[model samples]
Target: MDKNRMELNGFKWPDGDVHCRKVVFSSVIDMEPALRLTDGRAVAVQAGGNCGVWPAWLAERFERVFTFEPDQTNFDCLVQNVPENVTAYRAALGSKRGRVGMCLDTRNIGAHFIDGKGSIPVKTIDSLKLKACDYLCLDVEGYEMPALIGSVQTINEHRPVIQIEDKGLSERYGYQRGEAIDWLKMLGYRVRHRVARDVILSCAPA
Candidate 1:
């Protein structure tokens, strides 16, 4: 049996960090803006859902959470850790439908990213065809631009609050550092808050 299991914030997690056996997100994605702006708390989406920690938390706030993870081992952990209200997809979120390779992080599973070269299926947030999206959080290790590009339609339609991790990792995907903020600006999302490693964007006026 796989021994990579442990408790994280009172939830089951398939521990993967060889260095610490636990990895923590900088902070939970804020849902207040989503709840305040949207008519209903119907759906939320999370990319790079390693082991399901954040998604599990989202499950309590949204009626449904659709999470995506491309790593097989991590996907298994995600499926096991997340609550029944969450739907896990074993695929990477990108700007379109396709397959790509990943640059795996053996020490920190959450750090895995696209290398543009393997068989991991890449999907777009729009592919979910959700009736409503109250919130969306993406931490794709710098491949956020493509993921955001893929989510344009959904954002245009629902204007959900979006939280993106921007630890200057976008360069790996050929995007200028901090480019996502500009992209979101064009979509009419102003930065509402800057948490530890994420920037929360919302359409709500200040």
Candidate 2:
């Protein structure tokens, strides 16, 4: 049996110094994010899932975890470390369904994104069939906006708790920050918890 451990919050590899604890958010707010996974039956979508550390951990708690990463090197690492329950895909998620050129930031593996001055393949969340994700984690460099846009159907269907990395990097990737928040709000998701550069959004069951 593998030993289970919990570290404060940190990056997987290559981007080791990007500590989750050190993330700085624009606002100081505390809203309880609900992670109701007592049933042990939940789906997940980990866009830009680098090394699968967080999603792998969630797999231990949930019955099924699905992760995605476009980087080949990171995908290899994910396969080695992720548990059997966690399924990982080597592809990028976007507003459309197709392959797109990607940029590999060798220095900061976590910063990799779609290529072409800020573009990449896009896949709709509905097409991924991730309808009941209990927890959805997004760490895509600057493409978070498009990923979220493509996931509108899924968000409306599952209303899973989402943790997104929000900074000023969106503009670099041809996106706007306000658009991301507005989209989530349109889907009835509210900010549950925020820590530095990360914001967790959740929607209560109706």
Candidate 3:
């Protein structure tokens, strides 16, 4: 165990955020908007399942939760920790289907990002062909734009409430600041709330 990493519920967590049951961001900012909009019947797609905390949280409020984690170590933790109803994918979600590498972090497991040259597999959200997706949450470091791009079909069809982490770190993925929100706006989705680094978005009603 690293001095800065702590183990809980059989999962390795960043020491600073190892509070009771949260890996990082709480459900209030990450999962609540969707629950409120869909009345807890939202079928959710989420990414960066650091230690399964978010997915477990979603499962409690949403009808079904599908989570993606690209980090093998974190994925291992996620699988063992998430509720049985929460489907966990060990691959990262992106704009295309393929494999990429991750930029590992020593301190924060959630800080790992796709650096475009690793063995980790990448799958598009569209690839899932989900029948219903009323909510989507993405925290994939700087790759939220690509993930959103990959989810265009679902977004267009279901008009799900979306919550994405927008910490201005997209430069690592060659995107301008606020690029994801800008692109979403182009599709008529507007920001509904901004909590810490997360931005909640929903389609404007017709």
Candidate 4:
């Protein structure tokens, strides 16, 4: 593994597991907003809820949480794991609004995507018109860029701290990795740190 890349635990991401259980953005970091979730009305928007690890964790800190997942199996598991404060949606966040076919990752539930023969509905963040957001976490395989593009209005309006998995750029998942960073920089968000598979970026004031 590259020195900069994190070493995967064999138990959590055993070898030969093509899409292991290792990609969701859990709120394990020590960021102030994330850590201080109990104080404010933290609203979290999760692009890919997966098995609901992030949403379950976020529900403890934030007042309200919104999570979206395209895969039925994963969505079902997510709904079961999260609390009542967490609102789960069955859809994909993309650059546009409509249905598309998503390629399923049989091994890693978190690695599913709307790539080919997706057959899933894709919607933009702008369409939801959420009132406010304190933290935004995205992990939609390699489709983070389109999802981020569709979230321009939300990002600008809410200026919520954003965390995105730069997988597509480095791996064969979505778009080029640098695309996500460049877009964030263009939007005035700064790279706060990297945790596991995602880079934590923040533009909203701390």
Pick the lDDT winner: 1
lDDT of 3 by residue, 1-206 (tens): 75655677565665654343443644544566545655336588889888888888788877789999988767776787788789998998889988898887745676788886778889998988989988898988889999999999989988888888888888988998799999999988988888778888887553
Q: What is the lDDT of candidate 3?
A: 0.80
Return the TM-score for each candidate structure.
Answer: 0.89, 0.76, 0.87, 0.79
**Residue 150 alpha-carbon offset, candidate 3, angstroms:** 0.7
Best to worst by TM-score, what's the order?
A: 1, 3, 4, 2
lDDT of 3 at 179: 93
lDDT of 1: 0.81
Off by over 4 Å in 4: 1-40, 169-174, 204-206
Q: Model 1: which residue pairs collide?
A: 101-118
Model 2, 123-188: lDDT tens digits are 666687764766677778777788888887787777778878788678877678656776787888
C-alpha lDDT (0 to 100) for residue 39 of candidate 4: 31
- Local distance difference test, per candidate? 0.81, 0.66, 0.80, 0.71
Q: Which whole-number lDDT from 0 to 100 does residue 48 have in model 4?
A: 82
What does the lDDT read for residue 16 in candidate 2? Answer: 38
Which regions of candidate 3 fall more than 4 Å away from where they truly are? 1-30, 204-206
- Distance (Å) between predicted and true CA of 16, model 2? 11
Q: List the residue pairs that clash in candidate 3.
A: 100-118, 101-118
Locate the minimum summed-lDDT window of 10 residues in model 4: 3-12
User: Judged by lDDT against the true structure, how good is candidate 4?
Assistant: 0.71
